[model samples]
Target: MISWLMLAQAAALGIAGLVVAIAGLARRPFGDLALFAAIGAFATLVVQIVASIIAPIAGAGPTGDLLEYWTYLLSAILIPPAAVLWALVDKKGQWSTLIVGVGILACAVMVYRMHQIWFVQIA
Candidate 1:
């Protein structure tokens, strides 16, 4: 994986988490702005996924636990869309905010795991 790209995505996930959590606290539904931000974060994840795939083919797999890395990768890739779908299903409801907030939290954790996996061998 590209360390810089992973870092960027992790930062994006943190920001998105803050945005969604604040919206939830404000008792507001997840709005277009939050959705767009989530999409941006997802895009970053997608790029990271591609990089991870390429890295292994280029003989650059991380020396850390492969299963753990893959678990985080899969979770990171799946969370956003599930949250977005939930939000869409309850567009006018406060539940959307909580759902998105949870999504953000999940992403944040996943990012941390990826970072750990990426650097564990080096450390």
Candidate 2:
């Protein structure tokens, strides 16, 4: 995994998470802005997934347990959409929005963990 790309992905998700969180705090419903932010975060993870596959082929593979790295990556990829879907389904006003915000934040943390598994931990 590339250091710059990992950092970029984490930062993007962090920003998205923050945006949604602020919206939720303001008592806003799960609206376009929150949806867009979540989708943007999801898109970043999708890019990371592509990078994960191509980076290894380009000889920039993880230094740690490949399985662990992939597990984190795959799980991180699922979070945003699931949160969005849940938010849409629950429809409990700001709480649902807040849940999405929290879920996105969790994804950001997972991305950081993935970076650690790829670059910090040793096999």
Overall local distance difference test of candidate 1: 0.80
Q: For candidate 2, lDDT tens digit of each residue in 42-116?
A: 888888889899988999888888998888888887888898999999777658888788888888888888998
Who wins the lDDT comparison?
A: 2
Model 2 ranges with Cα > 4 A deviation: none
Model 1 — which ten-residue stretch has the worst lDDT?
114-123
Displacement of residue 7 (Cα, Å) in model 1 is 1.7
Model 2: pairs clashing at backbone N, Cα or C within 3 Å:
none
13-105 per-residue lDDT for model 1 (tens digits): 887788787888788867876687678767877887888889989987887887888888888888888888989999888778778777877
